[model samples]
Target chain A: MNTETIQSAIHPNQNHPNRNRPPLCFVRHAVWPPPRWGIALETPPGVGMKNWSNEFIGVDWGTTNLRAYRIGCDGGIQESFEDVLGVSAVSDGNFAGIVRELRETLGNLPMLLSGMIGSSIGWRTTPYVAAPASLEDIAAKITWVEPRWTGLLPGISVLTNSRADVMRGEEVQLLGYQSEHGLTQYTICHPGTHTKWAKVRGGKVEDFRSVMTGEQFSLLKEHSLLKAMMHGRVEPDRSFLEAVETGWSGVELTAELFTVRANVLLSRLPECRAASTVSGLLIGMDLRTGLRLAGHDLIVVLGDPALVRLYTAAIEHIGKDCEPAEGATAFVAGMTRIKEMIQ
Target chain B: MNTETIQSAIHPNQNHPNRNRPPLCFVRHAVWPPPRWGIALETPPGVGMKNWSNEFIGVDWGTTNLRAYRIGCDGGIQESFEDVLGVSAVSDGNFAGIVRELRETLGNLPMLLSGMIGSSIGWRTTPYVAAPASLEDIAAKITWVEPRWTGLLPGISVLTNSRADVMRGEEVQLLGYQSEHGLTQYTICHPGTHTKWAKVRGGKVEDFRSVMTGEQFSLLKEHSLLKAMMHGRVEPDRSFLEAVETGWSGVELTAELFTVRANVLLSRLPECRAASTVSGLLIGMDLRTGLRLAGHDLIVVLGDPALVRLYTAAIEHIGKDCEPAEGATAFVAGMTRIKEMIQ
Candidate 1:
């Protein structure tokens, strides 16, 4: 890591015995105004870091949020930084500039990048390699950041005779999960703007589906006709079952949608009851679609703890079993496991 | 009828034999100039009648889209007029003047008022009387337009043991429906800005519901997050069923609504598809709830032809049945039935 990052990370309390000599050991801290921003502001790159070695700092280049972690030789964080730089920057015409900032901040350190950085808009499309091959196989062929920093982590393509799908950072998370749990296979779901439900067998994410259900849900309640019938948040109700029942009945959704707002306005139906109705419709459909492909009982979910909780509840309500797998911790753990195989 | 309205409606087609003016009629019509500027042109009341001895007319006042019928001795219309005097004047805070103009044009003849005219913002808030009554019940309580038109039929109301819902012109439609069908029991759905679904048994509306689906749909799709996701008319696979499906499946419509435009950017779920998805969810749930009350048999839908077509397709997909009933025609039949009863 850079020297300024190093000095900021070195605790002031760690004065040397001589009181004038250089000290050792560094710790990652969430200081106000993270260290990177301060370093870029105070000492521009070349003036300092003439004293560091070549090594990676962890990078999370996601579709909507960005963050980074610096690891020392002993695998400890020297610093960490995060921003809402989101992959959306590329969609808005600023991919090259941010890459320059990343290079300047981290200096010459070889970086291990995860997430959408491997996608087409990132540094360079590094095609994803499959799993069960340790970090080296999954490692991007050659992490290349053009002068402009326009690059991406090549996404892993899961395909068979019948289906095909691609995933980026979550693949790393899966690898981290597999290497950590020591399981031959598992089912995982990462929820966000685009929720990915994947099936891992022989330690490879063999297949998956992306559902826009979450996004659709948000739009419907807050922006669509359905919103008119609601008072936003409501006390939990059993009527949620009606929603699921409606889905299973296979009633076409198009024509009937008007009734949600209508019944409530008509006062023939209670407004509060709409919450469960909306929830049941989305989760129920996704569950039905997923079960059709993944064999319901054999699958497990990996997502936000709360979302996982809700997923579990919905599954149980529909006569299925489910549980949550911590995603972030699993990511670091899975990476650590790959670190083992590499050594 | 007011003198001028009687005169304008009478015209001198005497020897031409088509002067066929009805004793009294209540159809509303208006024609507008080019460019849809909404300028209305109506013949002054009494003068036209001076030329033809036996003629009168029925007028319908709405917030927008006005119409009237020139009738024969048997209540047959020899001509008609329609335009956009609509309730915009009142909605625009010009109530008094619009009412005065309406009075001068229609004269003292009996003219019926509905829509916003009965709203607190309209001509006056004419308290509604329960259904199953006739012109006698309504015309008897005419809210006189002083210094102008005198007798105006009041609106109608649906009352249950615990609640009361009212409609003016639609009440007229219901009266028309009850009298014409020759049956005292049926379910009627009036589809418009505020769609009303009513259950009538033994000549009285026993249960009814109002859904603000249309208004909400317009506001959200045009003004909310959904604005970005939309691409003109989206016809769901099975409009109501699929929409209801989403509603019932627990899509979490409310929570996910705000994310629509963002998700559109991330999921690339196709901007065109987003609108249909929203439509599908809301309308689908409406159909589901409606089905709950419709029971398992064929439901006779009293609504617009287009809406009836949608309802028929949705219900049939769910193994239920639908019979289309023209809302306007039913109103006419109901009026005729009531007239026969009175005669």
Candidate 2:
């Protein structure tokens, strides 16, 4: 196989003639097989490439959902599958059986799993690679299951005198972003249940911070008194932008959170706008801390497009630069890199 | 009845010869009918006092619990009753029936209700009296129920150019504290589900702020991922104090909250200490905002003794002087003042 061809295909933008152009924005199309940003896998030109046998299955098994990708020998996604059978859903501890089913359905390819699947509650307990961790550091520490072919990627941890933060699956995406952009210094904001704000320096994760923004938003919207007012979709409306400003203003968050209820009681805010207002507040405060830890002018927001849009709006509102990237694409790129390393 | 006698009985500290002595500290004894702080009621000296027919029952119906006090003609608590029948427990909206049962169990005294009992979900929808409101303003706005003898006190609201805050039952406690201490200027911190921090000036509520600290703590401890590590009672140990300092240091609270779980995972903190650490972080952030809104040197913390102790510790840790007051005592005093006004 031609190593240069695989590298060029995986990071299309790096070798693109128009590399100086502004970064591409990834928008999700309504139909399946949507066009990718800059990745377009071309058939290799030689017999050795056709005979390549390094195909693999990448699985992101989180708490609520599982996503699987089938990577071709040329390091491009051939097909994908999704299911709600995440790590937490395996109540009977039949993770082996679940993976067996996946292997049967998605071809008998070797498996690489990430996320809570490697935690104590999942299939096995994998140790973490402390920061400053690089893609090579993570690739070297992969823990193999009983089956020699199945490997679990180690998560990353940052322990200091003042803070402790950990991320299981996002490290792969960070590495993918680093490989794709070829930038040694920047910040990446991976927004999710535990949103992580990581600073990358010299092509390695120097340190990072995690905020329970999404979790707090869910808890308040579903269980607290604010639930009654938190109806309707969270749009980036005026109420949301105004709340974003309030959240970013460094007000005491716990105190400011009560305004979501008080404003409704006083009829100053419509009930329908409560959800977006709360979303803005959480994301704004998230950026408030994230921007400080970022230590960079430009932020690369990697996540679902819907959430990325909100973060993009908030980041821009806070007078910072940000680019959106799809999480799946980054995940695939990251897995391919690790797969190459293992081979 | 001799009015001076009733006034002297209620304001025991004010009339005490050694009033210059430091304020008495109220500690809960293990036994029932624990010793009172400064109140020592004396029977009125006139025949009119014996026939004073102005006895009333004060009901504080909240979301999770109900507390009722029977006020004698001398404005002291003659008897008290408690039940889990808060307003939220009444699924059928039989508030009148509930009040009828209360009157039947206790005597057929005219009933005066406070707290969520006056909310929209309660028996009646009493309008809010805007601050700067005093006891007289709230008393004049009380909404009577179907029975002329039953009345619901109005809550207080602060709708300013920048913020909106509302309080139901806590208003009574603020008024009660003022009536007891006669402080023309002070700050009151009523710690509970939605802790209220109010500023009183010239014997009226100037403005206030509310923090969802208690509710957030409950939600995180019971529903979030932190619940797994949040075992054991939240004591005021070293872990709790250190967390309070972190919380009060103007750190991003949502980010700092995640440390509760990370610390335990990294072995820097034990699982049992998670609850107290979280408690400290929340209360520390609570004081961070409450102290700024207080605008006074000494803050009067009024609530259950246990919660009050936590807030007092946090307030002192923030380098502020604070005094602890019983919430029930303040409620009873406020109700007595309202009853006297209505009479």
Candidate 3:
């Protein structure tokens, strides 16, 4: 098999020839030729799909990319693969075909899918379960795609008071942490394009708020007038901390945003540090409002390590305590618990 | 000038063949062949430039456009001309050549120029007069480009409490209104790409805040995810009013913005009204912050009539009082006062 085929299974985002490939999953016995599917494979010289026999597959299918895992009966992760053919990339509703192809490659093992794959735009339209729901309630609502595979359409949590708010995929991640660790109540901050702060209580996600911090940062960095000064390279921590403090101090954001340009003009700030300041500003605003809604000083920050580190620094800088949770691991753990509940 | 030349003098943005043309201000006795500049003049049959004699020239030379006026000694506007060749369109520091050309054609009676033509990027760099200064102080700061033509380089006002904000071009308009009306204290709202709320004391601009509301709206409408829903057509008044009230009610703007999308998804709001809602939301935020900073309930709304109307509605909706001032008239009045001061 070409290294590309192997790598396609390794780093999905690097290549995806088409978005309409059929679902194909397998524990291969040998390095096989690159399969004719949408996934563009590029396995590094030393890495290839592992030869693992017979295990139930767990999948995290999202909007831009997806990862699949082979899980042993004891819940050990046996093998894994990735592809960039996300729901957004899929064309003409050919998801069933992609799934079939994945089954052909993986030997038709039973499978479980989560994330946006179960949303209105995915393989099947799955209704969102309301908040104050348990893991049992969430798993009970899984949409069965076929006899062998089921899609775990996640629940949506709503906050009626202090303004209307809602969340979808994050509910699964929250349940994952709760089910694996046996915890009841806590606040978790998931940082991404749309960051969410969830308040969990009595083994259920009670309320949540989605802040457009990450999205706003991206817009300002890449598209706004801030883009000019943002390109300068500088260490992000100091500027980020300063901006966080400024934002946390309750300055009006719209008025404060002009300072990004004014500081550069006045030479009080260097150009390279503008982006970090913007990041801190947005994050700080989110945290300020989030903390108000959270009603506590301690928060569980959940996401990838890179994002988690930033939040940890910001939270600690604000004089608050926080615990970090890795998102991928949490996703798998949540999937295993839900699979068990479904069976 | 040919009808095209006459119309070009009449409608500046319609044609400008060259940017380096002079400050030629004249009330032509008859329609001459279209004066060759960048504008390809094709004035429809009916329109032409008026002929008058011995009038002082008033010019508003901004970043993207220029307007030249012939005014009688009594401050009566005799004839006016326009062109798209503002300071930005001037190539290779040709300001002198442009002025020379205008002198050649219009026979250079005393001329007064204002706007960016006096800033660092314009014809000549002029120092900004500090704030809390009187109209005579501002008028005295006019930069004389030649024996016959003087450029008014306005000053920047500083706000020490919340943040630092500065404005150009609008200062002249502010002074114009103050000069004509003899006002001592008031707040003026200048609405445009970057809306300004300036606090005036004893005919001097004391403090001002530059809110990026208009810039932010354009970004959200043209670049943000909100663009898709904003394309629908609807009467803007209702949605604008509703959004303004929502913002004035102390709803956090960042969190409240996402409702523009959510409402469409939930069928709670019609898509056509999205733009109005966005306008109201942004204006409301500005008014809330501006009114607070103004430290008064009464404000003079000065800008183009369309923009002024919106701000007026928003202000009145919040139970505040406002007076509308036409931007062009105020600009001319301010120029007349400055010209008298300089001479």
Q: Output DockQ, candidate 3.
A: 0.40
- For candidate 2, what is the total of clashing residue pairs? 0
Give each prediction's DockQ, rounded to 2 decimals: 0.08, 0.58, 0.40
**In angstroms, how far off is A306's CA in candidate 1?**
4.3
Model 1: residues with Cα > 4 Å off, grouped in runs: A1-92, A101-150, A154-175, A225-301, A316-320, A331-343, B1-343
Global fold similarity of model 1 (TM-score): 0.57
Candidate with better DockQ, 1 vs 3: 3
Model 3: how far is A247 from its true place, Å? 1.7
In candidate 3 the C-alpha lDDT for residue A264 amounts to: 67
lDDT of 3 by residue, A20-131 (tens): 4544423332335323233232221121222223356677787767677667666666656666667877655677656655554443456778777886668886776777
Per-residue C-alpha lDDT of model 2 across residues B51-134, encoded as one tens digit per residue: 225667788888866777777677677766665556776676778766765554444567788899888888888999999999
**Residue A227, model 3: Cα distance from true site in angstroms:** 1.8
Q: CA lDDT of A45 in candidate 3? A: 13
Kindly report which residue stretches of model 2 are placed more than 4 angstroms away from their true locations once superposed.
A1-53, B1-53
lDDT of 1 by residue, A1-343 (tens): 5444543332122332222434332334434343443344335334334322322456677765566655554444555555545564445445555544555554444355678766655555676554333344664353546321222344565434433345677776765677666776666666555566667777667666665556556656776646655554532246565666555455433333544544454466677777666666666665665555567435566755766665666667777666567765565555444333333
- Docking tier of model 1: it is incorrect
Query: TM-score of chain B, per candidate?
Result: 0.68, 0.84, 0.78
* Model 3 CA deviation exceeding 4 Å by range: A1-3, A6-125, A143-162, A232-236, B1-127, B134-162, B232-236
